[model samples]
Target chain A: MKSEKQLVELSLKDDKHFAELVERYEAKLSRYIFHLSSLDSASTEDILQEVFIKVYENLNGYDTSFSFSSWIYRITHNEVISFFRKKKARPQAISPDDVDEDYITLIPDDTDIPKELKRKELAAKVKKAVLELPEKYRDVLVLRYLEDKSYQEISDILKISINNASVLVNRAKEKLKSKLTI
Target chain B: MSKLADKILKKVKKANIKHKPRWQFIAKRIFIWSALIVAIILLSMSVSMIIHQMTVAKPVFSEHFQKREFSPIFKLVPYFWTLISLLLLTFAYFDFKQTKTGHRHRPTIIVASGILVGIIIAAVMVSVRAPHNMEEQLQRHPLYQKMHFDKDFSKGPGALRPLMKSQANNPLAFPKN
Candidate 1:
């Protein structure tokens, strides 16, 4: 395994290598945040920059003992959630009535979902349902189900305990089930 | 896979952005020009000092005899040390600013340079005053006079400093060191 310091030194030498980290995580994270937020490309792009800048700033604090991917993804998740918080305030012009309820769900995407997208629309529904849940529960749910992270990964990312993550996910799921049904 | 991942990849790719040519240009421009100005001034001062010292020395030290006159501030070590340190720092700052590798360390460099400036000022002040104070102590204190700068010199200066002291009362309330 390469040491974190070695990777950092390489990243310092080449911005392209640092670009590789962006290529690695940006889309899925963007999807995760987009489901949470109704943010457009420019806004998502702005928050995404904040996430990477935070990662660059705190890379030295990365406990080499942990996975670098998880650490950075955790930061991305936090950034999006905070984006929701700030944007949620000041009363959005988007009212709850403006949301359409005409979402379609065919056969759980078992046939067409690429293996990489193992959960497919199931994950998308979970993300949508998660966004509908109470704020606290929604963040945990999206990080857990949409990302398909292990409970420990969820805990590490959320800065919560394993048990809290588990509990939050369950509460989020129950709320999601109720929300998705309607 | 690339298409499925494209949207997410877009986010990450944006993060690894080639921060626009304009911002890079600005960072490099500001850093390089400031560093060049500082280097030029420091270089001119050092060169002039060396030329002045060599030109002004009395003949006993100026002729083929060739003895160097040491300024109290410049003496006791190599003259290029401070200049070399500044040059290295300027190189580091511009290098970081140009490459995007050193933004996090900008704070460290700023704080370290501030401390270095403080230390250099204190060193210059102490270097100027120490010899003058020692000369006065040498003539005034017989106990220190008998101990004139030898194996016992270290202890003698500390002993003499106490006798020359006047008032411990700092009534004018200066800033704490």
Candidate 2:
């Protein structure tokens, strides 16, 4: 398998290679869109399509200094924000059905959860609490925890300073802890 | 391929969507960088001019203070240059933020650094008397003299009327003893 950078170079020459890039990122970006916006699969697909089209159109503009992943995530982030702006509504909580094993890890260890509560129950509560937080804090938490992005990557994705990224993550975690306690 | 990817691919193919030309992106990057550099240069020049005016007008300022005439002191300040410098600094800040790694820097850092850099460059320009030369060049322009000197003579401090009168005759003879 070619490296992503190599694939980008190939894609620049031939549209066929762009298909591979799209395939590689489809599942990941789709999940990200779903996680950020609780849009149904159809809406998610539509957003994902727009994102890919934009990525293809601006492929030449991509700065190679940053990771391709961060660049793509940034574009997706903008698209999601645009989606919300157009709809004139804030993001709703992630549906309980979408809350899965991955979200279980998002529950901070410091939280004094009762031993009686099952993992799934705890995960659902955490998801709801997280999505209920302010959009800025929620974005940082999702990117930091669910997306497993580094501070630098989060900074790039969100167009914030690295220090700011770290600060937002800490604040988001604190907010989540308070929400869980309530 | 996944169904969504397949669908997107089909749509792209049907639409004949192509990557925007490389030169357009390059041109945009160049334009941003050029604008940033120009803003910084203009900011530095304005700061240098302010410094030059302050330094040259130091004797006048002291003379006013000694007499306890405080109102004219405010007039000695280079408000035009100061405003220009501030506007350029703001422009430079926003332009810097548009760069690829610019977002990595905090606003305070960018602004502080911009001021620091502008001051450093302005100091260099002052050392070479670039602002003084620029003033002299502008004074040579009939419109500049008419607009600037006429305003000063009409509303200037009585203490500096003699200096302005001499400057009007010989623009380079600013600090007539």
Candidate 3:
């Protein structure tokens, strides 16, 4: 398999190759955009398109030192931020219906909470809890657990130091724990 | 590819989006840095100029104390420069934030650093420019000259005498020497 860097190089030369790059990342990035911003699918798609276009526009500027996925995620993060700034509103809450078993399993277990709760019920509560979080904490949690990005990758994507990113994740988890406990 | 991806891919082709040449990115970044540097320098100059003027432009201590009414005075020019400089520094700060890797630090840290750097530069520039005798210069202006002679100078034949070139030598009142 060609590496992501090779694909970026190839995409620079051939537009069709860029389609392959888009196909490679679209689903993961889309799901992330949806969860991270609680944006509706159409707005998420528009922002995603802008992100890809921005990626193509600055392909030569991509630093080899960073992972390609981190670079893409950073662009998407910027676009989402810009989108919210232009709209001048807080991110809308995600629908509980958007929660799935993956996220349900991803949630950290609480011993105090009843272990007998069904997956669906737990998922719904988790979904609402995640949505109620402040944007900073929510972003860290989404990138860390939902997108399964490393601390370094989250730092790169969010343009924060690795220590700060780790601190943020811990804080976010604490916030989530508190929310879920209630 | 999914339908949305296909549509975006098609749009990408139609947009004729291509990799910006490496040199272009380099050049753009250089330009932004240069602009930021210039803005910082200008901001420093503005601040230092204001500080220097304020320190130097005061009325003589004896004259100020002797006066009965503490007449309110307005001098907008010095503060106007300061305002402009602050505005430029603000723009430069935002520009710096937009640069690649610019977002790594907290904004409060960035602002505090920017201000500290600006003050350091202002200190250096003010020392170098050292506007000596700005107080004397302020005292010799036409407005002050009219005030020295009382408004009657402007209302009477003295006004017809045409302003003297050696206004700098004129004193409002000779101090005990």
Tens digit of lDDT per residue, candidate 1, span A1-182?
A: 44545665566555445556666667867776565565666887878777876665554455555567668877887887677677774212232333222222212223333345334444555445545567778667656655677877766666655666777777766665566555
How far is A103's C-alpha from truth in model 1 (Å)? 10
Give the Cα lDDT of each candidate: 0.51, 0.82, 0.72
lDDT of 3 at B58: 45
Docking quality (DockQ) of candidate 2: 0.69
Poorest 10 consecutive residues by lDDT, candidate 1 chain A: A100-109
Model 2 residue A136 lDDT?
89
Point out where model 1 deviates above 4 Å.
A1-6, A88-128, B1-177
Task: Write the residue-wise lDDT of candidate 2 on B58-118 in tens digits.
Answer: 7767877899977767767777788889999999999998898999998999999999999
* Per-residue lDDT value at A174 in model 3: 83
lDDT of 1 by residue, B59-174 (tens): 32333244343332122222443454456556544544433223323346644754355345435543454323433444486664443221112353233232223223211111
Docking class of 1: incorrect
DockQ of each: 0.01, 0.69, 0.33
**What lDDT tens digits, residue by residue, belong to model 2 across residues A22-128?**
99998889888877777788888888999999998989988888999999999999999999889897766555666665777777789877888777777778878
Q: iRMS of each prediction in angstroms?
A: 11.0, 1.1, 2.6
Q: Which one is best on lDDT? A: 2
For candidate 1, report its TM-score.
0.41
